[model samples]
Target: MSAMNAPLDLPLHAATLNPFIAQAWRERITPALVDYIAIPAKSPMFDADWQAHGLIDRVVRDAATWVESRKVPGLTLEVLRLESRTPVLFFEVEATQSVPTGAQAPTILIYGHLDKQPEFSGWRADLGPWTPKIDAGKLYGRGGADDGYAIYAAVSAIEAVKAQGALHPRIVGLIETCEESGSFDLPIYLEALRPRLGEVSLVVCLDSGAGNYDQLWLTTSLRGNVTGTLKVEVLTEGVHSGDGSGLVPSSFRVLRQVLDRLEDARSGHLLPGAFHCEIPVERIDQAKVAAQALGESVWKNYPWACGADGGLTLPVSDDPVELLLNRTWRPTLSITGVDGIPPLAQAGNVLRPFTAFKLSLRLPPLIEGHEAAVKLKTLLEDNAPYNARVTFEPDGRVGAWGASGWNAPTLAPWLERAMDAASRQHFGAPLGYIGQGGTIPLMNLLQQGFPQAQMMVCGVLGPKSNAHGPNEFLHLDYAERLTASVAQVIAAHP
Candidate 1:
C-alpha cells in the first residue's frame, strides 16, 4: 500500500500530534519561521569584530521577544550573559500543575545555537542565503536548518502538546551564540546559570542531521576536535633562494616532512599513537543500515573533483558500515591553513625565514583532548628534520562524545515511533539512525552535568543542506514534520 493510504496505529496519547499539531505547524509556525531565519547572526569566528557588528544582539532580542510572547503559565524567559561578551538566551518552561510529592515529570532540555556561519554573496536566482525564501517546498535560508528554526520548533512542539490537554514535559531551551567557534564561552554560561537549569532528565539537541530528508538520523557518536598552530623557523629573515637553497633548510619542506609522519597517503590511516578507540556493535549495525539506504549514490553525493588528476579517490570500503564507522568513530587530521607565505604576485625568488600551518585533528571517542594535544606537539617537535626550530601553539579543542545510554529503552522506541509516524504521514519511510563526525560539545557537557538525562540529538539539515556554505537552506516539508515529531515525543513521554 502507498504511504499516503496506509493506516496509522499511533499511540493513543500521541494522536493529538497528528492532524492538530501538524496542521498548526504548517499554518502558524512555517511562515513566521522563514522571517525569523533571514537575520544574519554570523558567528564570531567569521566576524571577529562581532560586537562592533551588532547583528547578534538584534537576533538575540528577537528571540527573547518571541519566547516572551509565548510564555506558558509557569514558564519564564531570561537573557543571560557569558564571559568574553557572549550572550545566551534561556527559556524555562515549567509544568503548569505540580507533580505529587515524590513523583517528578521528566524534564527535557532542548539545545540549539542562534548564530550562523557567514554568507558570501553569490546564489542562484531568488535564493540568497540571508534572504529567506520558500521554493519547491523547501525553506531556503542561512540559519534555518542549522539552528534558528530549532528554537521555534521546540517551543511550538511544547505548545501543541499543551494545547491538546496532553501531558507536557518541563522543557528548557538553552540557546547560545558561539557554537560555530567551538563553544568557547559556553562553560561560563552554564556555570552561571546552574540554579536555573536545575536537573534535566532528557536533552533534545536539534543541531545535527542525516544524509537526506528521506529518513530520520539519530547521531550516536561525535568526533573530537583538536586545532593548533605549527610554526617552523629556518632563518631570521627571507634570503635569496640561490644563496639559501643548500645552505639553509627550508621551513616549508621541514613542515611537510613532519606532516608525513601523521597519515598514510594511500590508506588514510593515522600513524600509530595518533588515536585509539573502540567502536560499539550497535553503531556498526546503524552504519550498515545507512549504507543500504544510501546505495552506490553515497560516493557521488560527496563533493569531489571530476578528473583523476585533480580529484579525491573514493574510500576503499564499499560497505556503508565501514565508511560511516570511519567517519564517526576514528580520528583524522587536516591542514586547514598556511601562514608566512607570500602570494604568487610581486614575487622574487626568496627563501622564507619561517613557515607556519594551522592543523586540525579529529579525535576518537576514547581520546582526551588535552592528552591528544600533548602527544601531537611532542610528535611534531621530535619529527622535525635537521633540528629546525619548531613550536606548537594550542588553539581550541573539544573531546569526542559517545551516547551515554544506547538502550534508553523507553525514550528510543518513543522517538522512533514518533519519527516513523511523521515520516509515514509526510514522506512515507522508516526513520534512519546515524552518526556524525562533527563535534557538538554542549551535548557532552549537558550529559556530564545531568548524568541521568537521556540525550537525543536530531535535526533538519540533510545532504547538500550546505550549512556554512554560500547557499544554505532548510527543507520546509521536513522541518514541518520535524516539529510535529517533537510534539509527538513530548506528548508520548511517560
Candidate 2:
C-alpha cells in the first residue's frame, strides 16, 4: 500500500521505538558521540586557523567513516568541499520503491551541521567542554547536544523506517561544517550542488531547540543574527590612570556612549529604527498558543547561574507572553566578548589603549539583518565620543525566518498526527510549538529555494541544554523518541 494508507506499524510504536533506537544509541551512536565531543571542532569564527587545526576535518572524517560503516543498501556519502571552505558531508540514500501501491515518491532533503560553538567558560568543574561524561541518562559535552548527534540521528531514523518495511522518499542529507560561523560558505556549496539537490517536497531540520523534554517541540520561526565587532580607541598606549584620568577619557566610557545609540541603557530595548518592526498577527496568535503550552517554564526553564539573586530575571516584562515575544519577535543585543580587558587578578591602574567588544544582535523575523548592520555601523561611527577612534566592523548577517507551519495543508496535519502519536507513545504528551530565539542561516535559504516544500524543524536541545553556554548536554531518552518521531513522519509522508 502507499504510505498514505499504510498501517501505523512502522516500528515507531512505543513498544518497539525505544528498545530499538535506545540500543542503537547505546551500542553505536553514544560511543561515537563521545568521540565526536572529544574533538574541539570550534567554528571558523572561533578558530581562525580551522583548516590548519584540522578539528573540523577530523569531525567530518569521523562522521563520514561512521556513515560508510553503515553500508546502507544504496548509500553514497562524501565530504563535498569548496576551495578554502570547510567540508560538507553529503549523503544520498536511494529510495526503496517497493510499496504495493506503486506510486511515485517525492524527494526529501535533510539538513544539519557538524560545526560547533567555541568552548565558553563556566562548565561544571568535573565536566569540561571536550570531556565526554555521561551522568544519569544525560550526555554532558559540547556538540553532542547542540547538534553533533544529527548525522547519526538522521541515519538512524531512515534505518528505523527501512526495518519496518515502510516506504520513504529518496533522502538527500546536507551536513555542513560552518553553520555556527553564520554559514558563510554554505551558499557556495548549495549553488554548486543545485542540480543534484533538485526540488524537495519536504525539508527536515534536526538542529533547532525544544521548549521542554516531555514532548516534541516544533520550531515555527527562527530569529536572524547581525554580529560584528565594535572597537573604541582613545590613546595609542596605556597611561597611568592618575595622569590620564582628567587629561583623556576612558575607552570603556566611550564604548558605552557608542552603544547608547543602539539600545536603551536601562531597558535593554533597541533604539534604532532599522532594527524595529511591527509584529505579524499570525506570529502574535502563535505566541499566545505557545505561551499557554509553555506556561511558567517560558522563563523558568532557563538554566540560571547559581546565586544570581533567586535566579536571573528578565530585563523586560515579567509576563511569559511578552518575554516570548521579546525573544523571537523583537530585536535584542548582547556583547558576547571583549578584548583589551585584562583579568581581574592582574589589576592595573592604567588607562587601556583600546576596548573592543564582539556584539551579537538578534533581529526580528521581519527585519533585514544586513541593512540593520549598515545602520548600526553608521550610528556608532558618525559621532565619535571625545574624538576617539571608533570603528564598527560587521562579521556577517542573516535575516530571520518564519515558516508556514500551520498552513502547510498537505503535510502539516500528517506530520502533526505522526508527531502527536510519537509523543503520546513515548512521552505521554502531545507535541508543542514554540518560536526559537536562535538563528539558523540555512533555514531562510532553503525556504527561499523550496517554497513549495513543507518544513519541519525539531531537535533534542531542551530545557537547560545550554547549547552555546557551559554544561551543555543531550537528554538521551528524548533524543531516542525524537529520532523515532522523525522516522514516523518520513514513513507517513505522501
Candidate 3:
C-alpha cells in the first residue's frame, strides 16, 4: 500500500513512549537476544565454515521470524542473498507521513549487524560467549552489546512509533551478517538493492560506542583500518642460537626493525606521513566538549594492567583531550597476533627462521585505507635489513585492502535539533558528540551513496561494555532508552 501523510493530532509523549519501549525490550527483545547470544553465529571471517555451520543462517532466520511475528503495520521483510556470500535481512516500513507534493519521500535507512566477533579469551569464570546471563542490568555475552541487538531494537522502535500514532518517514532496514569481517561482501548487496533502497535522506547506524551511557553519543568521526600479515624470513630452518647467534640475523629482530620504520617505538606514532591527515577543527572542538563531559574517564575507562609496584598501566597521555585525539584522529598500529615464537613451556633453544606479525593499522578519518595499505606494504617490505625475505599480504587486493574511515557530513539543523530533543527526553541529558576509534565500513559507503543524508551513528557500547572482547555485555536500561530516542528522532524527520 502507498503511504499517505497522516495528521498526528495527538503527538506521542515521552511518558508513554519510554515505558512502552522498555517493556517491549524486557518482554520481547531480551529473550530473543538471549537466544541470539547462544547461537555462536560468528562472522564469516572468523568462521570460514560459516555456511557449513549454519549458525549465521539460523540467527538470520530467527530474527526474521521474530520480526514477522510482530506484524509491524506496514513492514515487509526479506532475506537477501548472493551466492557464496553472507545473507542480509532487508525490511521496510511504509511512511506514515510524506513530503510536499512531487518531492521524493525521504527514506531513513536503518543499519545494524548480526554477525559477531570471535570468542576471545579472558572470560570470567561464570561467563562465556555463547552463555547468556543477566547480571545487574547488563546482558553478558558475545555480540549482545557489539550489536546483535540492533535489528530487534530497530523493529521495536518502529513499532513504538506506529503504536503511539507518531508519523514517520519511509523507513528501511539493512542488517548484514559480515560486519565483523570488515563487511567485504556489502558492496555487492548494496549494488543489488540500490534501486529498491530509494534516495536515502538519513542513516540510523547502531554500530558504534557511547561515552558514558548517560546520554546518546553522536559518533562524529571513525578511524579507518588496514590489517595484514607481515612476515620476515631469515633462514630455511631453525638453528642452535649458540651456534648462529652472531653469524645470522634474528628473524624477530629483523621484523622489529621493519616495524620501527612504521611506528616510533617510544612515542607510538606512525612515522609515515601518508597515513595521517590534519584533524578537522570542528572535530577537535567537539573532542574538547566531550573531554569536559568525560574528564579523566576518557583514559581511565580502559582496563589497565597493574605493574609490579602497584601503579596501573596508564595511557599514552594523561590529558583527556590528547587521549581522545590519539585514539580518534591519529594513526596507530597494533600488533594483534604474532607467530614463529614457541611457547616457553616447550623450552627450545633454537633460533627461529621466520617471524610473522598480524598488523592492524588504524588511519585518520581522511586518509584512504586502501592507499595506506599499499604504502604500508611498501614501507615494510622495501629495503629489508640483511635482505631477508619479507612479504606483506593485506586482507584484500593491493588497491583495496580494508575499510576506509568516515567523517560525518555537516549536521542538518532539523537533525541536530531532533537529536538533542530525543536525548533530553529519553536520557534526561542533551546529546553528546564523540569520535570513536573503531571502524564501521558501511558508514563510508552510506555517506558516499547519500551525500546529503543525516547520519545518526549511535550505539550502546558504553564504558566497560567491552565489545569484541570477553565479558562483553549490553546495558539493558540504556538500550531501551536508546530505542525510544531512536523512535523520537525518526518521528522528527523533516
Candidate 4:
C-alpha cells in the first residue's frame, strides 16, 4: 500500500517506538546478532582463503535466515553473487500500495558490511575473537559493532515501523562481504545491479562511529586510506653489528629518513604540497559543534594506557577542536606492522639486511587515495639515502568521501526531530554530528551514483567499542535505541 494512504493515527513517537524496538531487540535481534558474531567471517585482506573457508558464505546464510524469519511483509531476499566475487545480500521491503506513474515514492537504500577485520591481539582473555560474550549490556566479540548488527538493525526498523501501523518508503538493504578488503568488488556488483536500484531519495549507512554511547552521532565526513608495505634493503646479508657499525648505514635509519619526506618526525605533520586539500568552512564549523558536545571525551575516550616503569604518557593537544580537526580532516601516518626484525630474545648482535614496514596512511576526505599512493611511492623511491634499495609497494588504495551537495531539506527536519526524540528518551541527551577519522570506501561509490540523495551515516561503534582492535564490542542498549531512531526516520520519510 502506498504510504500516502496509510492511516494517520500510527504511533511514531518515542513513547511507542522505544518500547516496541526494545522488545523486538530483546526477543528477536540480540540472539541472532550474538550467533552472527561467532562466525569468523574475516575479510579477504586478512583471510585470503575466505572463499575456501566458507565463512563469508556462512555469514550470508546467517543474515538470510534471520531476515526470512522476521517475516517482514512483502520482503524479497537474495544473495547476489557475481563470478568469483564476494556475495552481496540484496533484499527489499516493498511499499504496500501503488501510485500514479508520474508520482515518486522515495526509495531509501541501507548499506552495511558483514565482513570483519582480523583478530588483533590484546583481546581480554575472556573475550576471544569469535567467542560471543554479553556482559553489562555490551556484546563483546568481533564484527558486532564494527558492524555486524547493521543487517539486523535495518530489518528490525522496518518491522517496528510497520507494527506501528505506519508505512515507509521502499527500503533496500545492501550488505556486502568485501568491505574490510576496501570494497574492491562493490563497484562491480553495483554496476551489475544498477538497473534494479531505483531512484534513491536517501541512504542510511550504519557503519560509522559515535562520540559516546550517550547519544546518536551522525558522520558528516569520512577520511580516506592508503595501505602498503615500505621496504628498505641495505645489504645482501646480515653481518656482525660491530663489524658493520662504521661502514654500513642501518636500513632502519634509512627507513626513518624516507618516512620523514612524508611527515615531520617532531610534529607528526604531513609535508606540505603532498596529499592534502583545503578543508571546507562547513566541516570546520561542524568540528566546533562536535568538539563542544564531546568535550574531554574526544581524547579521554581512547583506551590509552600510561607507560609503566618510567614510560611515556599519551600526548594529545589540549584543545579538543584541534584534535578533532587533526583526526578527521588532516592526514596521519601509522606503522601498523614490521617485518625482518627478530624477537628480543632471539636477536643476535647483527645488522639486519632489510626492514619492511607496513604503512597505513589516513588522508583527508577530499584527497584521492590513488593519487596519494602514487605521490608517496614517488617520494620514497626517488631520493633514496646513500642510493640504497627502496621499494614502496601499495597493497590497496581506498578513496575518501564527503557528502557533496548534501542538502536534504525534506529529510533533514525529520532526522533532527527523530534523533532528538530518540536521544532524549533513551539516553537523556541530545544528538550530535561529527566527522569520522576512518574510511568506508563503499560510500564514495554510492555518493557518486546517487549524488542527489541524502546520506545519513551512524552506528553503534562508540567510545570503548574498540572497532578494528582488540576487545571490540557492541553497546546493546545503544544499538536498540539506534534501531528505533532508524524506524522513526523510515516512518517519517517523505
Better of 3 and 4 by TM-score: 3
Put down candidate 3 lDDT per residue, 258-314, tens digits, no spaces: 999999999998898898899999999999999999999997888899978999987
TM-scores, one per candidate: 0.87, 0.92, 0.96, 0.93
- For each of the candidates, the C-alpha root-mean-square deviation to the true structure, in angstroms, is 4.2, 4.0, 3.9, 4.2
Q: In terms of TM-score, how similar is model 4 to the real structure?
A: 0.93
Better of 1 and 4 by TM-score: 4
Candidate 4 lDDT tens digits, 1-494: 22223233324866877788888889888888889889999999899998999999999998999899889888999999899899999998897566679986678999999999998899997998899999999999999998888999999899888887886778888999988878888888889988778888889999998988878787888888888899999999999999998799999999999998888988888995766778888778878988888898888877767688655456558899999989888888899999989999999999999999999888888877777777788888997999999998887534421111121222355555655555555676766778888888877778788877887789988888999899999999989878987887787776
**Model 1 local distance difference test score:** 0.73
lDDT by residue for model 2 (395-434), tens: 8533421111121113355666666666666676766777
Task: State the C-alpha lDDT per candidate.
Answer: 0.73, 0.82, 0.90, 0.83
Q: Which residue pairs collide, candidate 3? A: none
Q: After superposition, how far is residue 435 of candidate 1 from its true place, in Å?
A: 0.7
- Candidate 2: worst 10 consecutive residues by lDDT? 400-409
Worst 10 residues of 3 by lDDT: 1-10
Q: Which run of 10 residues does model 4 get worst, by summed lDDT?
A: 401-410
Deviation in Å, model 3, residue 115 alpha carbon: 0.7
By TM-score, the best candidate is: 3
Candidate 3: list runs displaced more than 4 Å.
1-11, 98-102
If the candidates were sorted by their TM-score against the true structure, best first, what order would they fall in? 3, 4, 2, 1
